[model samples]
Target: DLKMLYSAYAMEVLSDGHLNDDKLAALNQLRNIFGLAKYEAEAIITDVKARVFQTY
Candidate 1:
């Protein structure tokens, strides 16, 4: 469930070139909505960061 949520969030966040504060807030809200633990959310964010940066 969290993985699915993360994928959806990733698609949204990646639509733009950056992850701004508003996007981050939305991500946190999404994490809460999906009942993801803090660590799980952090892990998903970290992975996304890695992929985003890897493109550079």
Candidate 2:
């Protein structure tokens, strides 16, 4: 539920093809709000980044 929401948000954050510090900060805040641990968020973000790269 929350994870899925965060995952979708993560993908949107990565849609620009770059994870700048500000974007990372935003993701961090969302992760905390969604109660997802840092590692889990990192894993989901990494996965999203990988999938995004595959399309390029």
Give the TM-score comparing model 2 with the true structure, all chains together: 0.93
Which candidate tops TM-score? 2
lDDT of 1 by residue, 1-56 (tens): 66766866776696555888888898888888888888988887888777777776
lDDT of 2 by residue, 1-56 (tens): 99889989988888878989999999999998888998999899989999889877
Determine which window of 10 residues in candidate 2 has minimal summed lDDT.
10-19
Candidate 2's displacement at residue 2, Å, is 0.6
For model 2, state the Cα shift of residue 6 in Å. Answer: 0.5
Error of 1 at 7 (Å): 3.4
